[model samples]
Target chain A: MMDILSEMLGYAFLVRALVVGALVSACAALLGVSLVLKRYSMIGDGLSHVGFGSLALATALHAAPLAVAIPVVIAAAFLLLRLSQSSKIKGDAAIALISTGSLAVGVVIISRTSGMNTDVCNYLFGSILAMNRIDVYLSVALAVTVLFLFILFYNKLFAITFDETFAKATGVKTGVYNMVVAFLTAITIVVGMRMMGAMLISSLIVFPALTSMRVFRKFKSVTVCSVFVSLACFFVGVVISYVYATPTGASIVIINIFAFLLFWLVRVLMTKRVAVKKPGLVLLMPLLLLAACGKSETAALPEGSAAQAAFVLEYPSQRGEAPAQAWLRQADTQGEADAATPVIEIKEKMFITQINDIYLNAGDYIGKTIKLEGIFRLEQYEGRQYRYVLRYGPGCCGNDGNAGFEVSWQPRTPAGAAPSQKAYPKQDDWVRALGTLQTYEEDGYPYVYLVLSSLSVLDTRGAEFVTQ
Target chain B: MEKDRPKDPQGIPSEPLILCKNLSLGYDGHIVLRDFDLRICAGDYCCVIGENGCGKTTLVRGLLGLISPIRGTIAFGAKIRRTEIGYLSQQEAAKQDFPAGVYEIVLSGGIGAMGLRPFYSRGEKQKAEAALMRLGMAGFRNRCFRELSGGQKRRVLIARALCAAKKLLVLDEPSAGLDPLAREEVYRLLKDVNRETGMTIVMISHDIAAVEKYATVVVTLGKEINAVGVGGEKK
Candidate 1:
């Protein structure tokens, strides 16, 4: 373990990762307390998506990601603040809209752009392992600025967070203070994005604040405790990632989750133990238990044994179910089949199959004869040629699952007879299309293609996915 | 009855300390009070009385230039500087376990006077200490604001307001949640400050009995100034 630690410390990238992680954790810990107190916990998530889009655009244009991301995130923060001010849209709704929309736009742009080696997944999730000295510097600078601002405005911030009208009446510039907070939040998201990734970044912003609040009472203590908790999580995560050779970002998030659970469990156990000594403690036991159970259930699981165990624990009945056995049915006998039916020779055509399983090495079998299922997205560019994108509607396809792929094909029928060429199937409509496999280059990137021989729409309706 | 009414102060080019003409106050566009005109003079201890949402708080806010009136001009006297206005809102129970000390909260009152400068001066610190001393909160300065009882927090907030203001003071529901002894103590403190310093005071309260006893000028607000009583004289 020491050898691995020494090796990790020797690498400049690893040092950068450690420094950036610690800085981001500190900054996030301080700001996150206010967010949690205000019940605007999702602001971090939304702003991070805005940052992701900004970074992608900057990368595509060969500009500095931080420069582009900072302004964009600040603008998004202001926009969110403005939207939240409106009586029509509540706070969470505005956050969700901006977050999802920005991420969607980011993914679409990334899909179209070339020559940019930036991985969408890494940005969405996080890549602390890939940090450089510049990233470290940015994070440190941001952390110090946030810390200074926090200290300078500590009293006013407390006053406003608790009660805005009172703060304003007492001569605090509530509007300017709020704007400063929003700006700080934007900076924190942009700085932390490299460490936490857009998706899991909010976890860093939320988890430590929540855990600290469980133990600490005062705002100052909460900020201090949250920073300590976040720093501990970051260091432990880095060390564990280095020792286990796991993804650093995931390792960090998992460490936070573990700490959260441990804190929650300790809280619950203490409350229960206290109940035995004092009956008044019994009143708090249920709340404590609920909090502990809630955190353990909600904590993001790592992509290994821990996750598998959590999945099993969540669905015990499903876990006990036996795996399906392959059937050994008898093959059709030549004597029973009126054996001498004349065989018709059919021409072998290249067909493209829908992506049934993206989790496997299905790319090698792209041009091979394979059967798959998906919905059809039809497009018209030239005469009577029905070009479509073959897609599968997975649960949370855009957010979590790699749901669909693009496919170009021509229907067998002449104009007007082929499934209303202008009327494309709505997204996530289940369909099956038989097509020949063809490799082609579009915008300087090779893609597997399927030329459709036949197509039929299945019974499944438009996109089916559960949303929280 | 019209002939017996007091003549309106018409054609007075110079502004009063607070002048509201045909003003309306409300949340959104819904009017809570209409056609309300009030004129407060320098050193006038104006106590406004009404039920919740009856525009008492709104009137106080309007006078301070925090909220714009829907349909009127709110003019302040030429001598009345904007920074001279100090306001204490209804005392909310501090989350009892908050981290900041009483001195820290009290010092926040001087933030506006300091403008955007990074640090506080020694003079500003001395003034904050003086304000706390005046409020009888000198010993509790090091104690956390969250650790104080209901009345202590009020006194601390009063110190904060004192630290902020140069001349005028506005308080909203200062006696709302306090016991009778605490409420009387607050009233006495206000009376003593006004007598000694000659500072302009405006307060919002529902305590009709107390306002009659303590207010120099009592303004009862609803659709309009229901009555403007001078000292103990009923209108």
Candidate 2:
């Protein structure tokens, strides 16, 4: 366990993931108390779905994703607030309608444009590898801003959440404070989406508050305990995910569920002393069972080093074109299309699938230099250590898909400045490897590989996962 | 209560603190009370008596400025901002389930008077404590509101109202669910508060006997202001 912990700590991505998780956890808990008390807890789910749709739209339009998503999700929050106030639609029903509709729209957009690849799937389930430096900085800035604003309006929020009518009667602009709450919640959801995913972000906003409420009766105590509990749960969840290779978002939510149950159990045990009554035990049973169902088989790393195997940079075989680009090259099959077709440039959104397609059909692009970025995984086969650039794509859910390209050093690094000299990346270090594409046969099947001209281990900590 | 007597700059005791002229009150464009006229003087202990759905609650709400009047003008006294008149709404829907202590609920009453300040000031806390003490609920300050008996909750709410009101208090059915003894106790407390401090009190109730015994003024409501009379007035 210590070995795994130390090894995991060596990677910058893991550190970035933990930091972002903590920031978001604290921010969510602070707002969660008010949101839960106000009966607007589901707004988190509503806004997250809106964020998913906005993220998909931004990805499709090739816009700066957060820039597009933040404003759109904030607007959706206000819209939900207005819709809930309208007599025609109830609050819960409004949330359900907006959330499901936005989720469906997001799914449709992803399927239409990105063709339902791993990148899109990551957004659904979340990937810690998605946290690059930009994301960390953004999360930190926004999380701090949210925490500050929440504290600035803490008392007013307490009044509004507990008794909005009374708060208004007491001369509070309850409408303005309500808007402030909604706006802060929207920001928390959108910023948290990268690490927690659209599907599970609401758990962070709900479970901590509920858990704290189970034991504490005072609003101030509940809020303070909620922040501490949420941050603790998130820390433990991240550590569990790191050690067991579990899905980060689900692990965090599962931890929160357990914390809630534990707090409830403590409450039950202290019932004689505390005079507390448990109201929702019957309703909680199935929910606890549902949370338990989040367990999935841990994804394993791929084995066998491609470095020992002789790689021929030249392809003697003719596979007309990569299957993804087959339609564009259909007319050129007779060998007259070299000059007519431009090289297919792989974008971040489609990099995983494109690299996979190129590997599966390695004959089309032999000498072309392709630039790709992913976590670096080092494995040993036949006494030769090989570093593979890997990425986890959407495969049903968080537990399943692993797709990546093997990096083959051109004029392989001299033995003197070998693995010992340069710290070979641990299992999940984000790196940008630029190399000429090569094909090598393993057993009998040919696989596309990268022959590195220059490798720069990218510092993409807090970076968003690629979603096309 | 003697030391805390209401300091009204208008020395004339008959001056109205709240006046409603030809008022129509209801919700959503449906008028419940039409052409209702009433005057509440600074030291009046007014008991508004009515049958169910006769617009007593609507009249009180309109007077509190919670709802707008359909036609007439309801004016506040010179120094009275709408919020300065403390109001205790009818037993809110399952408010006992709220996770607050008696002290917290009482302290919240002063939230409006806190202005832009985020935290309660020392003076506000002392006032809340004094309000609790006045209702003989100082011992229950830290007790959870949900665990309190219905009668205890009423006293706490009355204390909360005291925290908000500087000159006037309006309560709607403050003794609705209590037993007769608890109801009498609450009535006595209100009567004392009104008599000793000269804080104008308006309450909606069905207990005509209590109203006759405790009220300085009585306004009977039925579709409109049916009767207004001075009952057991000190003057």
Candidate 3:
């Protein structure tokens, strides 16, 4: 492994890849925190698509991608800024429209042109393993320029981001600053496109910021943490990709996600333990009492004390009828004694619901009965988990929007786990679940949650919950 | 308002510092202001004011040669070199997330003055630093523009504008968002520059309160020129 690594590192292309990757990662990381804070993570993704169109146009014209991509992307960025300023469309919608439209134009243009088999796929997805010396030089120069510009205009930029109206009043050229930011974002995206690809570039712009948010509070600290996390993830990802012969971009993204999960888990566990020991833990005693009513006294209470184990789901049941009860009947035999127990159910095919104040004992609920119904999203390798959202909805089936949440199952596998359901549900697939609730410590938080024992896919039309 | 005039070898009062007659400003074909006549004698502090979007900015754009007037001729006095017009646009907030320092931003002000010069020189550096010091921003010369508070940033921008101005200064909304104290400081700085150096200062501001305190002459606009005053009194 050492010999192979040494040989790989010795190659100019490999060295270039490392340098360019580091530079782009560092620059993106600096801007990523602000993007996430502003909830504009998708902007990077959109710009990447714009960069793709520019690259295609450049290739077709037999021009350097940097020369062509920079101006085009900058123009698109300005256009996007202009469009966002208009009240006719919301910012995200504008971004989506431009992103898709530009990419489509790029695809059509590429198909029409001949002899330039530029492997646009690599730019779309990323190809760090194939980086060359020119790529490194360009990336480094752009990164340095970005850093220099950012530092020079740091105060002006900060004022703009924090409050544009206020900044404008203070004699800061808010419009010019905004234009500069858009221009810089374009530069970073163009440079990074070849390594991260359009699809995953936003992840590079988001994950590091999220990880840093877990550890840092001040804006300066957030930026520092973001750069550190991004560089570390990229380096580790490159090594792993080399060792395993996986796609470099995908490997890096996966590593970032893993880091995010690790941070999230640790935070959760720490918060949970702290909450348990705090005075507030006593307030939860009543819920525990209710949960303990059915279970044995010494049945090894989960993270939540027995007194806090009771489940208090605030599901939006129509006319006070629980949707879970209806789904529970479908999971069990027709005459099961407890099948008649009141469970939450949705009478309307499409409606929003909020689940709050839910209490369960992590240990005792591990294999206990649970019936949940909502949209289901399954992660690869992880078995079917019940996904529900806390959201507001319009009459019956209209305009359902939600905050994101997911529930897991336990016993590692229930008594009758069938072949994991294929046909991964689409964006909004209505789902019902009959599962045993389980509790585990992710990071440091003790979450008492349900694990799906059985699940049924409901008709898709009623799936109105939109996740944030 | 002509005073003592220095003569060139073949001098003719060196022409009016700035001459505009029947100037018509507009966008596309729609006219905003027309048949407007104005002149700035050397070293005059001219303040232009109007209701929001009532062609104040358009006039500034015209003065800076950024926009063309539809039906007018604008002639600069021999002493009024085009490079002498130092324009400080309304404080545009920098993207705080950007990683740039104050010194670099101040340096950019020199871009106009350099006029395609390939590189910065030691003289330019000295000039930039002197400008910063003049604005009392020497201590913050190395600070990142984003890290500075609103007041500091405004001062730095003022410093930047000064760095580029050799004879004439034009500012847009120099005190739009500052607190009372910062606004006063800005006015004081403007006054000091005008008093000590006799630099021409032209500015547009919505703060009517500062008219009596700072403006040498105020030009108020409406469908036409509403009033022309000196020290807040109708002339």
Candidate 4:
């Protein structure tokens, strides 16, 4: 079991996956408290569908998914808020209209182009391995930011969520704060889509909050407990998927379901023990939970073994020898035809596949040099230096996976041996390194590492964690 | 000469704390009340009495700055900002399903003072606690609001409004859902708060008996401020 765990961590994709899963779940839980309490949990479902449509359109337009989905979902959220507020439509009706409409649009676009393939399935139920290096970093940064802002504005949000009219009467600027809530939720939904899938992502936002509400009544207690329970359920779900080989997104959702049920049972037992039969209180609990439950109907019900099948999903291999005809075509089109071009300029989104191909066919470019930029780090094992060029991006569903490569760096003056290079380049230093590929045998397995001839720390300007 | 006299003839400070002059109130351009004129002075327990759909609630809402006047102006006194007036909308305003403690409900009264600041200050919490104590609900601060009796909930709500109200309070149908006993308790509580604190109160109610018994001033609405009464007598 330990060997399996270590082996899973050995893959950078898995590490990135776990990091993103933790952050996304934390964010979902924190925001979920207010959403659930305010009876806006379905907004997550509604916005996720909008995100799906936006992502499908972005794919059709050949644009970045996050870049396009973020703004589009935000606009949809505002539209939902406005429609719900108007006398023409009530709450659930407005949500249903927008959610189904967006879902239909997404399905239509996907069928037209991708032909309703596994990519659509991946978007619906999540594909954990599909994440790349940049996704993990972006998720981490954004999730932390959401957490900080939520805490900072906790009182105002509480006021607005609980009693919006009173909040406005008190000068809370309920409209602006409502928009802020919607905007933040959209960002979270878009970021979480790659890992949780458009269908199952809202479950992370709804379950922990509903579950915590059952056990706790006060807003602060419910919110704080929700954060803890959300993180736990996500971590456990990721581990369960890893050990049982279940679908990542569905696994996390299953864990949340169990937590919800467990909390219900505990509350029922506690209430029975106390025998506090206050009139209408018992009937209202189920009604409130049911209201929150209806919006989550589309998430995590059917995706199990079929979801796993979709997990390993990709179009049939096009090339037998190279197996990366698409990547080669991309490299060729990017004006890298000259063999002596020294440093191949790999674009941001293409970095993962390029590194994967390079690692697989190490002998193809043994002596040739390359240059890249990423967060730098140093690790030591048995008196040998194991410096790495690390970057995290979107992998398959964000459950318990990451997409990045392990580029082991050979420092010019081995940091561990000399101890002087440590002052220059430390962990999290964004530096550009010029290096040559070196392959070696480790424990009878062929592994790829890099030997750097020149390394320079670039000025930290215009540095973005998410590459378009 | 008497016809030209101010509405209140008791010489109880003729200037009004809030004055609605020829105000027209409505929803979506449909006028409910037009050319409405009403005056509420400082420390007045003013009860707005009217038949069903006569726009008593609309007048209260307009006074609280919740609705716009279509034709005329509703002006506030120098002492009050729009946010400073305490408003307990209705018994149905705070839903029974809301998962909040009595203390939280009261604390929310001070939320207007917070503005853009993220968290409530220590002073706000103290004010909420003080409001709870003032309402004789000190021990019930931690009690779940949903589990409370209708009368208790109304008191808590009033206390919450007191936490925010510097000069005025406006309540609409506060005793609508309560039983006879609960309704009497609520009326008595409102009366006591009015007489003791000298706080201006504007209430809309169908209970004419209670209105006759407790109100310092009464205004009957029939598409306008039809009648003005002082100390239960028409001026």
Summing lDDT over every window of 10 consecutive residues in candidate 4 chain B, give the lowest-scoring window.
B1-10
Backbone clash pairs for candidate 2 read A118-A394, A131-A461, A131-A462, A131-A463, A132-A460, A132-A461, A132-A462, A132-A463, A133-A461, A135-A462
How does candidate 4 score on lDDT? Answer: 0.70
Per-residue CA lDDT of candidate 3, range B1-235, in tens? 3323233357543345777888888877688887788776565667889898788887877777765778888888877677565667774644545444567666545544543243556876787898788767899876656668777787777876776677788888888667888788888788778766778788998878776566666777787764354634443
Per-residue alpha-carbon lDDT of candidate 1 for residues B45-135, written as tens digits (9 for 90 to 100)? 7788876777787777777766777888878778776667677887473454345567877776766665566567888789899988887
Estimate, for each residue in A322-381, the C-alpha lDDT of model 4 and write its tens digit.
Answer: 333343234334423443556743433334445554553456667667667666767678
Which portions of model 2 miss their true places by more than 4 Å?
A: A1-9, A272-468, B1-10, B13-15, B93-96, B179-182, B195-197, B226-235
Model 4 misplaced regions, further than 4 Å: A1-7, A111-118, A275-468, B1-15, B176-198, B227-235
Q: Is candidate 2 or candidate 3 better by lDDT?
A: 2
Q: Write the per-residue lDDT of candidate 2 for residues B58-110, one digit (tens) a residue.
A: 88888877678889999887857756767787856233445776788888888
Per-residue error (Å), model 1, residue A94: 0.8
Best by lDDT: 2
TM for every model, in the order presented, reads 0.66, 0.73, 0.50, 0.70
Model 1: docking quality category:
incorrect
Compared with the true structure, what per-residue lDDT tens digits does model 4 show for residues B1-235?
0112233347655467888788898888888888867778777788889898898887777776666788899988776677677878773445455667788778888878766676778998898998888777999988877788767887888788888876677888778767887688778877777666667788998999898777778888874466565533453
Query: Please, what are the lDDT tens digits per residue for candidate 3 over residues A131-221?
Result: 3345557779998898777766654554445444433333345677778777877888888887778777777788888786653434555
- Each model: TM-score of chain B? 0.84, 0.88, 0.84, 0.84
Positional deviation of residue A317's Cα in model 4 after best superposition, in angstroms: 25
Best by TM-score: 2
Error of 3 at A337 (Å): 79
